[model samples]
Target: MQKRYRIKREKEFQEVFAAGHSKANRNFVVYQIKKPGQTHYRVGISVGKKVGHTAVCRNQIKRYIRQSLLELSDQLPGDVDFLVIARANAKNLDMKETKTNLIHVLKLSQLLLEAQAE
Candidate 1:
């Protein structure tokens, strides 16, 4: 995924969490907030302590999320930011599963518009 779209700050994460509409599915929890003016979305990856404690584990999960977002980057709506908050289930999933699950939730949340739907 584009580096510009990654949510990093503690405050920004908090804001996305606060600003977004949330939903929980079998695979993940999605937090979505609309950004009307942004030409592209900013996605934040959060793998909290409950998921794993090691950096490698967290990075692996995030890498899976990022790679999925990168593949679907061209498909995203122009005016939305997505925050993918990882659950315990996300910790062990392989990249393909991770990507599919994330995309599924994103579509369910209506972040991926019809123009972008695959």
Candidate 2:
């Protein structure tokens, strides 16, 4: 993801955590706030040591979540800031499951613009 589309600063994460509405499944938590003037979505991913003891494990989880978001970016709402927090069970999932679970969470939160009816 490009710098403009990624939320990199500490304060930005805090702002999202403080004000964004959130929803969660077993492996992930998503926080989002809609800002009126913004023209694109900015996302932050957080995978902590609690989720995995090794850096590689944490990074792999981050990569999977990022890939999922990237795939759905075009259909996601533009004026929102999203923060994705991975839970410990996330470390146990493979790439495909990660993407499916992430998309499921997005759908539950009503964040997926083109989400289809079941």
Candidate 3:
């Protein structure tokens, strides 16, 4: 994902955590907050140590999340910020499963557009 599309600062993450609405499934937690006037959505991803033992593992999880977001970008709301937190079960998932699980969580949060639900 591009830098402009990522939530990079601690304060931004906290703001989303404090104010955003959240939804979760077995593998992911999704938090979304509307940012009116913004032209595109931004996302923050977190995969804790409990989910992955090492930096490489954690990064792999992040990569999966980023890739999924890239593919779904056009289907997501342009004026929202999303924070995705990975759970322990996520570590074992491959790319397809990661995307599936992420999509499920996003749908639960109503972050994905209606026409994109398929």
Candidate 4:
């Protein structure tokens, strides 16, 4: 993901946590807040020590999430900020599983647009 499309500051994450609406499934928690006048959506990802024992594991999880978000970017709302926090159950998932779990959570949060049949 690009830096412009990511929420990278502690203050930004805290603001989202404080004011955003949240939804979750077994593997992920999604916090969403609308940002007026924003041209595109931004995302913040968090995979903590509890979810992964080492930095490599955590980074892998993050990579999976970033890839999923990239694939879904066109379907996401342009004026929203999303924060995705991974649960411990996410540690063992492969890329496909991660994307599936993320889609479930995003649907719950109403962040994902339905895919159009062409």
Model 2, runs deviating above 4 Å: 116-118
Writing each residue's lDDT as its tens digit, candidate 2 over 1-117 gives 888999999999999999999999999999999888999999999999999999999999999998888888888999999999999999999988998899899998899988743
lDDT of 3 by residue, 48-84 (tens): 9999999999999999999989999988999999899
Q: What CA root-mean-square deviation does each model show from the true structure?
A: 1.9, 1.5, 1.2, 1.6
RMSD of 1: 1.9
Candidate 2 matches the true fold with a TM-score of: 0.95
Q: In model 3, which runs have C-alpha deviations exceeding 4 angstroms?
A: 115-118
Ten-residue region with minimum lDDT total, candidate 1: 109-118
Candidate 3 has a TM-score of 0.96
**Tens digit per residue, CA lDDT, model 1, 1-118:** 6568777888878887888899777768888788788887888888888898899998999889888888887778778766888898888799888987887888788776643444
Please say which candidate is ahead in lDDT: 2 or 3: 3
lDDT (C-alpha, whole model) for all candidates = 0.81, 0.92, 0.93, 0.93
Give the TM-score of each candidate: 0.88, 0.95, 0.96, 0.96
